[model samples]
Target: MSATAAISVRGLEKSYKGSRQARSPVLKGVDFEVARGSIFALLGSNGAGKTTAVRILSTLLKPDAGTALVEGASVVEEAQRVREAISLTGQFAAVDEILTGRENLVLVAKLRHLPSPGDIADGLLERFDLVEAGGRKVATYSGGMRRRLDIAMSLIGSPSVIFLDEPTTGLDPEARLEVWKVVKELTEQGTTVLLTTQYLEEAEQLADRIAILHGGTIIANGTLAELKALLPPAKVEYVEKQPSLEEIFLSLTGSTKQGDHS
Candidate 1:
C-alpha cells in the first residue's frame, strides 16, 4: 500500500472452485490505488470482476494471489483493523425487511457500539430525507428509499473508507441523481469512496478518477480529462445550422459525458 492512498491493490487475484475442474480466475493480477478523500470509480462490464475486487477490499473475501490494503492495513493479515476503516454497500440493500427504517438505523448504530444510537439514527434519517417514513417497515419502502437506508446504515460507524458496488443500480433517474449527491457529499467530507459501477455516466458524475476493467485487468485508468485527451476532441453538427441533436443534448446534459468515454 502506498502512503498516500486510502486503498491499494497489487497483483491481486481471486478464483472460484468447481469440482476437480480448474478454478476460474475472476481477478487476474489487478493493481490500482484510490487516493484519500477521492471518489474512485471502478468501471467494468458484468462479470468483469468488479464486485470481486470490491469484496476483497471490503474484507468480505480474500484474494487468492497478491495483496490488498485498506487505509494502509493489509487486508489478509490485518483484516479486522482494515474492516474497521471501511464500510461496504453491495448490489442489494442490506436493510431488514421486518424492521422499520428507524429501527434498522438504530440496529446498525447499536451494532457499531455508538454511544447515542438514537441521535445517530435520527441524524442519518433526516440527512437521507427519510424522517417521514422512518417508522415504516423496510418492506414498505420503495427501492430508492431502501437503497438510501442501506447507505445510511453503512455510515453508522462513519468508516473512513466506503466501498460501493453499483450503489445506484436499480434507482430511477431522479433517485440516481439523489444518490449521486449523497456520494459527492461523502467525498466532500473527506471520506474516501471507491465505487464500482457498469454505468459510465455514473462514474463520470461521481468519480475523481476512473479505472476501466476488462477481462480481469484494468485496461485504462485516468482522470476524465486525461482519458478524453487520449481521444480526438469532438466536433459538432447542427441540424438547422443552429444546433445539432448532439448540441441540444450537450446543452441539456453538460460536457461531462463527452469525457466519459470509458
Candidate 2:
C-alpha cells in the first residue's frame, strides 16, 4: 500500500454461500488505492460489487481473503479504529423523519459521544446550507435537503474518510448537483471520499481517479483523460452543426425549468 493512500485494498476477495453447494464470488481480487484528501470513484453497473467493496472498506463486512487499510489501520484487525476514521452514507437517506435537521445532527453527535453536540449540529447545519431549514422536521424537507442532512449526520464523528454509495441515486438533476458541490467542498477541506456511482458523468465531474469494476475486479483504473486515451482514436469529420432540443428550447423560452421537467 502507498504511504500516502488513505484507503488501500490489496487482493480483496469475498464470496457468499449459495442455495446449492457452491459459493458465489462477489469481489474477486479487487485492488485500488484512494489518496488522502482526494475523491476516488468506483464506477460499475449493478451487481458489479461496488456496494460490497464499500461495505468491506467501511468494516460492515469482512473480506474472505485480502487486506484493507483505512488511514494505516487494518480494517479487520483494527475494526474499531477504522470505524472511528470513517463514515458511510448509503443510497437512501437515513435521517429521522420526525426529527428536525438540527435535532438529527445533534442526536448523531450525542451517539458519537462528542462534546458540545448542539454547537456541532449548528455548525453542520450552516456547513450544509440547511441553516434556514434546521428547525423544520425532516419530513418537510426536500429530497436534496434530506440527503444533505444525512451527510451532515455522517460528519458528526469528524471522520477522515467517507463512503458514499451511489449518493446521487434517486435525486433530481438539481439535487444531484447540490450533493456534488458538498462532496467537492469535503475534498477541498482535506477529507477523503470514496464514491460508488453508475453515472459516468458524475465520475467525470468528481473523481480525481476512477476505477471501473466488472466481475468483482477492477478492469480499468485511471483519470478520465487517461481512460479516454486507452480507447481507440475517434475519426474526425466536418459537418454542419445542429442545435440540440435543449438549446432550441432555451433560445425560444429564454429560461429553463427549475427541476426535472421530464
Model 2 has a clash total of: 0
lDDT of 2 by residue, 1-262 (tens): 8999999999999999999959999999999999999999997766778999999999999999999999999999999999989999999999999999999999998888889999999999999999999999999998888999999999887899999999989999999999999999999999999999877678888999988877788877887666765544545568534433223223333345312211
Worst window of 10 by summed lDDT in candidate 1: 240-249
- Count clashing residue pairs per candidate: 1, 0
CA error at residue 232 for candidate 1, angstroms: 2.7
lDDT score at residue 157, model 2, on the 0-100 scale: 78
Model 1, span 117-195: residue lDDT tens: 9999999999999999999989998888888889899988889999999998878898788789889988898999999
Model 1 TM-score is 0.87
* lDDT value for model 2: 0.87
- Report how far residue 60 has shifted in candidate 2, in Å: 0.9
TM-score of 2: 0.90
